[model samples]
Target: MAMIEISGLLLLLLTIFLAGGVWIAISLMACGWVAMQFVAGGIPAGAVLATTIWGNSASWTLAALPLFIWMGEILYRTKLSEEMFRGLAPWLNWLPGRLMHVNVLACGIFGSVSGSSAATCATVAKIALPELKKRGYDEKLALGSLAGAGTLGILIPPSITMVVYAVAANVSIIQIFLAGFLPGLLVMVLYSGYIIVWHMLNPDKSPPPEPAMPFRQKLKESAQLIPCMLLIALVFLSLLLGWATATECAAWGVLGSFGIAWWSGTLTKEAFWQSVMGTTRITCMIMLILAGASFMSTSMAYTGIPLALAAWVDSLHLSPYALIAALTVMYIVLGTALDGISMIVLTTAIVIPMIKSAGFDLVWFGIFLVLIVEMAEVSPPVGFNLFVLQTMSGKDSNTVALAALPFFFLLVAAVAIITIFPQIVMILPEMAFPPQ
Candidate 1:
């Protein structure tokens, strides 16, 4: 009952702070301070806060975050998406949805290198939207597909969200990265399949199929895609093949992205400065949130809140799937208010113990967590991708949300598939880093 009251007080304070438009990181810190001083009591809150923030902020695994962000920033300024469109258009032209597949393919490819959902959505849409519209493609399908496929950024690795989960849950970032691969591909295939089915059902919505391009000509057009593909292969394979750590591969990614930008004649001084600034701003935001959440996590521990809650939850003897279903509902509600990272950081304190008690693998749960966040990315109220699409398409959030509805359900379907077949999320990691 005391724990219930403490939880209620903290939740009420957090809701008030967030609703009042406080920055999430600061709101989290304030909540942690309140918990420390009132709920936990007796600890030197200042000392614990300072040390915990510093330790988490200085994490070597986290060094990869900014580097990966910088790489995405550089590519975002380049014509990579344009090149990918040109390369992919001819190959997919005869397929049921024709060039619409480019949105999914390009997002999947870009997401591999970018590791950010918003960046992937914005970057691909910047080029694909105008081009697809020009070719008389269906606006709703293009928009929805880009929005859905963009989530590949977090699921395919070098992912910032994966890094945060790794740090919070104390798992191998590499293993998490590896685990995400097959599932990411699964989502892509599911998305593409949906597009094919949609076009088949409503053939007139898509532009009429064009004549098949000469095989050799298709190959030539695809040459425009070589540099970006090579960079992705370099970054991804290096990590997968054990040639480098996640941080080191990220560094290589940055260098390779810069080289590609320069080689493509798009790396201007202005663009360089912009990429640096973008990386700094995003990195700082994530770091502050990480620091604040660290402090809060520590405070929660000192208060015995998480352990008590876990004990209570365990006593109920809910099955593993039941616990996951409950968490899914909780996270979706939280998603309407908080972004994915904040949700992960704030809940890890309570969720981890329940997960362990249910005998689920944390790494697999990390993938599960990411897919749910991907769902949240398209969800309304605070969905980041919805906001992004609204700005680009000039549609109201509701309209954009409606267009994204199919893909949203598709993401939910992905979660269910992975839940029933956990190996889909586990196979690559086990093969890559087999149990010793």
Candidate 2:
């Protein structure tokens, strides 16, 4: 069979399974089974499936996922979001956007710890929306900024999405983490810059400025943030400075999160068990997806699908930029229906080879992939962040999605900026681990 035919067949099977409401991991596994049974003769599909799952599951580096997730889960149950708002509001009121910047800053901070976009969106929005409403901020802008900035959960260091991408792409988890740092900050700047520009143009939309705070008062107000800041510093610096592996840092982050939660007096027995249960559920889901994806990748390798697809793409004689443009569009379409991790796992097997053939660095492409996935988080229908904000604000999905539209474009702008200046994604990684 032709590669295109096989590709079409697999795609059809996947669509059928998913549209039939099969779980994503099972759908992926089913697709792999069909591919191996009919497309790749004599491959011993059952043995391959068992071994592939075991190998993917037993990965030492993959251990970081659950620990980081548990860390986020622990912090999620704390009063951190309320404290964060109190601490950050005084500092941000002087900005043109005033307290609206809290959504962006708070999401970035909380995301560093949480690593889950929905959790970050939900956690920050829980505190930010009511406060923004009380302060007479524009509802659309408050919702929009929170929806947009909430994606920082995946872009910042200790991102769950980054871990899945790095493991799938067979790259350094730390390098991918480092690579994401600047791009994440770039998105924050873009979101905040948009807020500032919007406020300046429509000054009446912002509430009257609060009274100025004395420096000591400002410092005192921000004191609650020290533990969170220290936790971020410890995990990030350990990764950047080579003091620990990603998994080690995650373990330390988990310990640090427990300490912070205890200090905040929110680490009750119930909260601890809830955090553990949340981590278990999330980790099990992700690992199942990873296992299924690994098997499918192996099956595709046996059938030569990825290489053939790469060759077909190569035959198009498209420029590197053109290929990237095509991929960006493809991912955007995928984002409307799939969550971020699903988008990454389903495509990376086929996409990474094409990327390497185009002479693009995998680490850079991982960051690019993440930025595109971030855009997906705000997209309608299946956009998780949109759903999060809608639930919090008691708005319909359309209103929440419309509010997020500008940030969606900002994410597009972010993608373009990184594509044009690839150095932004590469600088930190290169600085931390220069090529020999």
Highest lDDT against the true fold, candidate: 2
Q: Candidate 2: lDDT of 301?
A: 92
Kindly list the per-residue Cα lDDT of model 2 for residues 98-155, writing each as its tens digit.
8889899999999999999999999999998888899899999999998999999999
**Candidate 1 per-residue C-alpha lDDT over 1-436 given as tens digits, one digit per residue, 9 for 90 to 100:** 5896788789899889988999888998999999999887888899998999988887888998899999988998766667877888788776788777888988988898888999999888888889888889888888899889888889998799999999988899999999999999999999999999999998777776677779999999999699989998887788789999999999999999988899889889999999999999999998988888888889998999888888888888899899989998898888887889988988887789889888999999999999989988988888888888899989888888888899988988999999999999998888889977
**Candidate 1: where is the Cα deviation over 4 Å?**
none
| Residue 297 local lDDT, model 1 | 89
What lDDT does each candidate get?
A: 0.89, 0.93
Superposition TM-score, candidate 1 onto the true structure? 0.98
Model 2 CA lDDT for position 96: 98
Please name the candidate that would achieve the greatest TM-score relative to the true structure.
Answer: 2
TM-score of each: 0.98, 0.99
In angstroms, give how far residue 327 of model 1 lies from its true place: 0.9
Query: For each predicted model, how many residue pairs clash, with residues at least 3 apart or on different chains?
Result: 0, 0
